[model samples]
Target: MLAKRIIPCLDIKNNEVVKGINFEDLKSAGDPVALAKKYDDELADELMFLDITASSEKRKTILKLVEKISENIFIPFSVGGGVSEIEDIHNLLNSGADKVSINTAAVINPEIIDEAAKKFGSSTIVIAIDAKKVGDEYLVFTYGGKKNSGINAIQWAKEVYNRGAGEILLTSMDKDGTKSGYEINLTSMVVRSVKIPVIASGGARDAKDIEEVFVKADAGAALAASIFHYENSGIISIKKYLKSKGINVRL
Candidate 1:
C-alpha cells in the first residue's frame, strides 16, 4: 500500500513565512528560506509555499524565493499565488517548483486550468479550494477567503476536476487556525465529488485529527501549519500516531 504523505505548508507574506486565522490577522514565523531548509532536513514528505498576499495584491510569484526554497529540498515542492497563465506556471516550474497550485485566477477563469494541464500535465496542476461553511452548506471562497463566489464547495470541486486539475487542496476556513479538528463532512463531500486526490487542510489540532482526516474524512493526505509551525506538534509524532492507528504513513 502507498504510504500517506505528511506535508508542511508555509504561508509567505512579504518574503517571510507567516500564518493567520481564517486567512486574517497575519503574524510572522521566520525567514521562509531558512524554514524551508529546516523542513527539508526534517525529512518532511513535501513542502508547500503559498504567497498568501499575491492574489489579493495582484503581483507575480517570487521567483527568488522559489529558487531558494527548492535549492535545499529534494522532496517535491509546490508553489501558488498570482498564477494566472501558462507563462506563470512555466516560470515557476522553470524556477524548480515540482508542481503549481492556482486559486483566485482559477475562480476568475477556469480555462487556465486546461491550458496549464495541457502544457504541464495533470500531475503538475493542483487546485487549492478555500471553503467556509455558511449556515448548513459549505461555500467556496476566493482571494484568501476575502470573497465568496456563491458556489458550493462540492460543485466547485467537480468543475475544477473537469477542467483537468490533478489534485484538490481543500482548506476549511472556519477550522483553519482553531486546530480543533478537520471539516470531515466537507472533506468527504469533496473526495466524493472528484476523482482526483483530495488533500485536507485546516482544523488539525492533534494526531487524532490527522488520523480522522485519513480514515473517516477519507482524504488523500492531511496538511497543517500553526501546529507544526509553533513546535506544538511534530510530523514524526503525527506519523507515528497515524501508523499506530493502522494507517499507512512514512515513519
Candidate 2:
C-alpha cells in the first residue's frame, strides 16, 4: 500500500500566510517562505501553497512568492490560485511548483484539463475542488470559494480523472478551518467515485482525524493548517502518531 501523506497547507494573502474559519475572517499566520522551510525541515510529506485571493482579485499567482518558497523547501510543493491558462501552469511549474492546481479555470473550461494533461503530463496537473454541502447535494465552488459553480462535486471528481488530471485536491468549505475533522462522508463519496488519488483538505484537528480520513475515507493524503500553524502539533509528531496507530506513513 502507498504510504498516506500529510501535507501542510499555506494560504497566502498579500504574500503572508493566513488562516480563517470557513474561508472567512482571514488572519495572518506568518511568512510564507519561513513556514515552508520549517515544514520541509520537519519532514512534512508535502507542502501546498495557495494564493488565496489571486483568483478573486483577477491576477496570476505570485510567481516570485512561489519561487521564494520553492527555494526554501526541498519537498514536493503544489501551488494553486489564479491559474486559468496553460501559460499560468507553465509559469508556475517553471517557478518551482512540482504541481499546479486549477479550480475556477477547470470549471470554466474543463477542456483545459485534457489539454494541460496532454501538454504537461497528468502528474503535473491537479484539480482543486472546493465544495459546500447544500441540502443533500455537494456543490462545487470556485474563485477561492466565493462562487458556486452549481456542479455536483462527486461527478466533477470523476470527470476530472477521466479528463486525465493526475490528482484531486478536495476541500470541504463547510469543514474548512473548523478543525473538527475532515468531512469523511463527503470525502468517501468522492474517493469511491474516482480512481485517481484524492488529497482530503479542511477541518483536520489532529492525528486521529487524519487517521480517520485515511482509514474510513481512504484518502490519499490529509492536508491541514491550524494545528501546524498554531504550534498545536508538528509534522514529525503527527507522523509518529499515525505510525503508532498502524497507519502507513513516511516518518
Candidate 3:
C-alpha cells in the first residue's frame, strides 16, 4: 500500500503564516519561509501554502512568496487562493507551485478545472472543498468558508474528480482549527464518493488524530495547521507515531 502522507498546511495571510479556529480568531504562526524549511528538514510528506485571504481581498496569490517558498523546500507544494483563470494557474506553477488548488474559482467556473487539467495534466490540479455540516449533509463553502455555496460537499467532490481534478483537499470548516479530531464521517464520505485521492484537512491535534483519519476515514493524506505550525507535533514525530500504530507511513 502507498504510504499515507502527513502534510502541513500553511495558512498565509499578508505573507506570514497564521492559524485560527473554525476559520476565525487568527493568530500569527511564523515566517512562511522558516516554517517551510522546518517542515522540509523534518521530512514532511508534502506542504500546502494557502493564501487564505487572497480571495477575500480580491487579489492574486503572492507570487513572490511562492517563489521564495519554492526555493526553500523540495517537497511537493500546492498553492491556492484567488486562482480563477488558466493564466493564474500557469503563473503559479511557473512561480514554483507544484499544484494549483482551486476552491471558489472551481465553484464559479468549473470548466476551469477541465481546462487546467488539460493544459497542465490532472495531477497538477487539486480542487479544495471547504465544507460545513448542515442538516443531514455537508454544504460547500466559498470565500474562505465565509459563505455557503449550497453545493452538497459529497456531490461536489465527485463533480470535481469527474471534471479532471487529480485530487481533493477536503477541509471541514467546523473541525478546522478545533483540533478535536478529523471529521471522519465527512472525510470518509468524500473519500468513498470519489475516485481521486482525498487529503483530509482540519481538526488535527496530534499523531493519534492523523492515525484515526487514515485508519477510519481511509484518507489518502491528513493535513494539519495549528499543530504543525505551532510545533505541537513535528512531521517526523507524527510519522513515527503513525508507523508505530501500524499505519503505512514513511519514517
Candidate 4:
C-alpha cells in the first residue's frame, strides 16, 4: 500500500510564517526555517512552503528563504509563490527545493505546466489551486486568493492533470482555518475527476479531520498549518491516528 503523506504547511508573508482563518487576518507563527526544522525533527513526510503574497507582489519567490529552509531540513521540501516562468521553477529547484509549486502562474498560463513537466518531469511540477465556494459553484482564486480565476476548481484540476501536473494541492478558502476539518466533498470531487495525486489542505483541526480526509476524499496527503504550528498536533499524532484508521502512513 502507498503510505499516505502527512505534510506541514508554512504560509509566509513578509518572510515570516503566519496563520489565519479563511486566509484572512493573519497571525505570526514563527520563523519558517525553525518551524520546518521542528517538523523535520518530528519526521514529517514533507514540507510545503508558500509565500502567500508572492503572486500579488508580481515578483519572484523569495529564494533566499527557500535556500535557508531547504538547507535546514532533510525532508523533501516544495516551494511556491510568485512563480511566473520556467526560470522561476529552474531557480527554485536549483536552489534546493525538491519541487516547485505554481498556482496563479499556472492559472494565468497553463502552458507553464506543460513546459515545466517537459523540462523537469511531472514529479517536480505541482499545480496548486486556491478555491472558495460562492453559492453553488466552487471558483478558483488566484494571486493568493485576492483575485478570482473565474474557473471552476474541479474543471481546472482535470485540465491541469491533462497539462501534465504530477500533483495538485487544493486548498479550500471555505475551511481555510475553520479547524472544522478537510473539505471532503470538494476534495473527493476533484480527486475522482483527476488521475494525479491530490493533496487536501486547509481546516485540519485534529487527527480525526485528517483521517476523514484520507478515508473520505482519498487524498494522497493532508497538509495543514495551524494545527501543526499551534502545537495542537504533531506529525506523529497525525500518523498514529491515521494508522489506527487503517490508512498506510509513515510511523
lDDT of 2 by residue, 1-251 (tens): 68999998888887777753232212423677767776787888898888866444434437888788777778899998778899989988988889999999999999999999999999999999999999899999988899988999999999999999999999999999787899999999999999889999999988889999999999999998768644447788888888998999987
Q: Compare candidates 2 and 4 on lDDT and give the better one.
A: 2
Indicate the TM-score of model 1: 0.90
Best by lDDT: 2
Per-residue lDDT over 68-121 for candidate 1, one digit per residue giving the tens place of the 0 to 100 score: 777877889899877778898998998889999999899889899999999899
Clashing pairs in 3: none
Inter-residue clash pairs, candidate 4: none
Note the clash tally of each candidate. 0, 0, 0, 0
Q: Candidate 3: lDDT of 220?
A: 98
Q: Where does candidate 2 clash, by residue pair?
A: none
User: Relative to the true structure, how large is the alpha-carbon lDDT of every model?
Assistant: 0.83, 0.86, 0.86, 0.85
lDDT of 3 by residue, 166-194 (tens): 99999999998787999999999999998
Which has the higher TM-score value, candidate number 2 or candidate number 4?
Answer: 2
**Lowest lDDT block of 10, candidate 1:** 20-29
Arranged by lDDT, best first: 2, 3, 4, 1
Please provide TM-scores, in order, for all candidate models, with all chains considered together. Answer: 0.90, 0.91, 0.91, 0.90
TM-score of 4: 0.90
